[model samples]
Target: MVSKNQIKRITGLHQKKFRNEQQLFIAEGIKVIQELYNSSFEIQEFYSTDSSLQLNNKVKPDIISETDLKKISCLKTPNTCLAVFKIAPSKPIKYEGLTLVLDDIRDPGNLGTIIRLCDWFGIEQLICSEETADLYNPKVIQATMGSIARVNVVYTSLERFLKNTKQPIYGAFMDGDVVYETELPTTAVLVMGNEANGVTATVEALIQKKISIPRFGKLQKTESLNVATATAILLSEFRKNLSGK
Candidate 1:
């Protein structure tokens, strides 16, 4: 059984302030918890229904009752299991492969979807501006499914990182040249903008190359693509460019 103090601590993770103060985050679903359980991130605690406990026995895990799992869960209908994990430590980037950077992406769902997209395309390290939604948010965690274990997301001063990085920078903009026509470098930072504001001028000025995914079909009034969908399209282009069969 989880204690009242533990529930308070777990529930507090729903708030950004508490998550930061404790350097912890909550993840639900047996799959996500199991994936992170096997990752380098510290497993702070675990809770599950009686049936769920049989899924694994690798760790000498702390067992909590179904009632306690519901109490600590942030979901309307909580999953059969959940976990509290120490937030992965942020570190200076050592660039090697294709890098993805986000400039103030605010929506948790979009961010989570983008993370899963990164995992799919094999772009593992993601850098984000400080204003982006917390990668540890429950909605983001749930949206990522189990892909969170495959990506290392680092949030910092995006502008500084862009300016100081040694590789060619690729970013999307409304007025840019077509992504298909341009020659993309293997080492590139595919920087994406926020949902509403788009990439700021400061970062735009640093963009070594600009590319756009042109609109094809009718309904030309399509304002813009959703950030996650755009990211999938862009990353797919990059991966195809790198390894087209």
Candidate 2:
């Protein structure tokens, strides 16, 4: 049974401020918790409804009643288990090849999907503006489907990072050169803008190349492509050209 204090602490992890202060975050569902366990992330505590469920000797979970489990869960229908993990120390940001730069991506789902895409396309480094969604947000964690374990995410000043980088910089834009025709470099930075505002003028000024995924459908119909979808298409084009397969 989870103590009252423990329940409070776990639920508080749903917020970014609490997560930062505690330096811990909770991941729900068997798959997310299990995938995190398999990765380098350190598990602090594990709680599950199923007594038979086991991760290892090191991670012996507190088997609790479903009622108790529900108290700490952020999901409407909590999964079989929830685990609190110590946030892994940020890995060094390697700006070597195909780095993804996010300019204030505020949506958790979009951020999560983009993380998955990065893992899929083998993009190693992802830099986000300070205003982007928190990596540790439970919703984002759930959306990532465990890709959070693999992708390296860092939040900092996008303008400063872009100004200092020597690699060719590319930003996704509505009225930019066609991505297909533009020759993309293997070692470069790709900037994805905010959902509503697109790239800020500050960051846009630093972009050496502006590329866009052209629309094939009706003209002037869709306002914009979802950031996550655009990321998938853009990353696909980058890898295709780089691999030449």
Candidate 3:
């Protein structure tokens, strides 16, 4: 049974301010918790309603009731387990290969999906403007599935980073060069912008190449693609080229 004090603290993690203060974040669902346990993130607290659900041969989770789990879970439908893990220190951004830059992507689900997309394409480092959604946001975490454990995400000033980078910078735009036609490099900085406004003028000014996914429908009336969908398409094209296809 989880005590009332413990419940309060766990529930507090749902907020960004509290998560920052505690230096810990929560991961619900067996897969997410298992992935984090297998990665560098250290497990701080583990709770589950089933005693048979083992993380591994070494660690044992504290068995709690289903009622207690709902109190701490962030989801509408609680998973079988929840684990609190220490926020791993952000590593220095390495501009070696295919660095993805997010320019104020405010949606947690979009950010989370993008992170998973990064992991899928083997893009190890992700740079986000300070205005981008928090990587540890519960919604983002849930959307990431287990990919959060594999990608390195960093938040910093977009303008400064763009100004200083030596690699070719590419920004996605509605009127830019079609991405399918452009010759993409294996190592470059690709900037994905906000969901509604697209890239900011300041960042757009710094881009060496502007790229876009063309519209194919007869009407061509679609306003835009979702940021995460655009990212998947772009990343696929980039990787497809990298393979010499």
Candidate 4:
């Protein structure tokens, strides 16, 4: 059983401010917890209703009741287990073959899907504008489906980073030339903008190439593609070129 203070502290991690203050975040479900356990993230605490669950970490989990787990869980239907892990220190951004730059992507699901896409396509780094969804947001972690453990995600100033990098920058836009027709470089920065507004003017100025996913529907009334789905198609296109297809 967990003490009232402990429950309060663990629940606090659901908020970004508290997560930052505690330098800790929560991962729920067996898969997410297992992935974090296998990764470099240091597990600070583990709480589970199942007493037999095995963990490789040196810290033995507090075997709590399902009632106790619910007190600290943010999920509507709490999973069987939840683990708290210390946030790993950010590594220096590696300017490599292809980097993903997100300009204020505010949706947690979109950010999580993008991270998974980066991992699938072998993109080494992901750069997000400071306003982008928190990397540790519970919904984002759940959406990543363990891909969060592999991808390197960082938040920084979009303008400053763009100004400093010499790599060719590409931005996805509704009016730009069809993506299938664009001459994509193997090594460059791909910028994905916010869901509703697309790219901001400041960041757009830094984009060397403007590209778009062509719509084939006769009505052509679809306002735009969901950012995550667009990311999947764009990354697939980028990987094809990298593989010399």
Candidate 5:
């Protein structure tokens, strides 16, 4: 049985301060919780209708009332499971392959989708601006599907990380050299910016080179692509070049 106080604490994680104070965050949906349970991340608690708990012996999941599950869950509709996981500390960044650095991407869906894209492209490391949405925000976690386990998302100062990187840096820009034409570097920092605003002056100043995606659609109305979609295209090109595609 999930107590009222316990529900209060779990729901409080919706706010950043609470999440930090407790060192835990909520993960909804059966699949998302299942993935976390299987990862190195420690699962503090989980709730499911079934009392058997046969999936993982380590997980001593508690049974909770449907109403209690709904109260603590972030989703509009309560999923089959909700898990409380200890927030993982930032890991040592091993920047060997094509890395993506995001500049203040505010949207949770965009960040989550980007994480999924990273998983698909086999890009292991992602560096985000300090102001970017929290990777463990329930929305971002859910949107990632199951890729959260694979991608190492580090939230730090984009400028500092870019400045220190030994590899070349490529910033995505609207008014820049065509991505397809540019001689793509094997290993580098690919900077993608916010949905509404592009890279800020501070981050922009650190960029050593700029590249852009050419739009082929009939409508001249589409001036720029969404940051996440643009990210997919750019990474696609870089990966293809790496594979001799």
Candidate 6:
């Protein structure tokens, strides 16, 4: 039983401009909402078709009909629940451990998957170029599953960040040193480029080292690996040697 005003507000969050204006973003499904609720992100509105669904037994959600839920859901088949959360304040970037950087990654799904990959490898800090997709984009949020709650993402100037950092910067390139053989530093910055363009020349110039995943197939015809897939493989290689230590 959502009011017309509430419906407009919630659906408006689907756009980046409206989301920024409202200082809020939407998350759907029990897992995503629950993970966010348990994290530092503050929940503004919670609506679900299931009254039995609970969030850590802390706050009860408003029960809404499925029709009303669909009115605001970004997904085609709406989940049983949706929650609007206040966009958490950006935290300071900690450069101690392996830091992941993105150079103009425009796809929301790619950005979200990369965030999840960062969470998987325990990479705490993710730096994105200002051109990267919005972290709070609903597609990105949905793709993150629940890992968005864990990773700290910041959007800034890639060139400035690279120039200012004392870390050994590495960029993923199709034509570069083999990643598998390269000795990765425990403390470094790894830059992944756009899906179509790879790393921008400006940022690529700042990379202290360039690494690539070698193609093993006989044809070697594949143009490139998907950015998120490349990220997972590279992160795995970076953390592989240090796993047990």
lDDT of 1 by residue, 1-245 (tens): 77899889899999999999999999988788888877777888877775436335665446777678888898988878888899988656866789999999999999999999999999989999999999999999999987888888998888888878888899988777898888776778999999998998888889988889998859788899999999998898888866855
Worst 10 residues of 5 by lDDT: 52-61
Candidate 6: pairs in clash: none
Estimate candidate 2's alpha-carbon lDDT, on a 0 to 1 scale: 0.91
Query: For each candidate, what TM-score against the reference?
Result: 0.93, 0.96, 0.97, 0.96, 0.94, 0.97
Candidate 3 Cα misplacement greater than 4 A, ranges: none
* Global lDDT scores for all candidate models: 0.86, 0.91, 0.92, 0.89, 0.86, 0.92
Candidate 5 lDDT by residue in tens digits, 50-128: 6665346666568987788889988898887788899988788876788999999999999999999999999999999
User: RMSD of candidate 3 to the true fold?
Assistant: 1.2
Clashes of each: 0, 0, 0, 0, 0, 0
Model 2, position 131: C-alpha lDDT score: 96
TM-score of structure candidate 4: 0.96
Model 6 clash number: 0
Query: What tens-digit string does per-residue lDDT give for candidate 6 at 1-245?
Result: 79999999999999999999989999999999988888899999999999999888878889999999999999999999999999987898776889999999999999999999999999999999999999999999999988898898998998888888899999999988999889998889999999999998889889989999999989988888999999999999999989879
Candidate 6, poorest ten consecutive residues by summed lDDT: 88-97
| Candidate 2 backbone overlaps, count | 0
Better of 4 and 6 by TM-score: 6
Off by over 4 Å in 4: 57-60
In TM-score terms, candidate 1 sits at 0.93
In model 3, the worst 10-residue window by lDDT is 236-245
Pairs that collide, model 1: none
lDDT, residue 1, model 5: 89
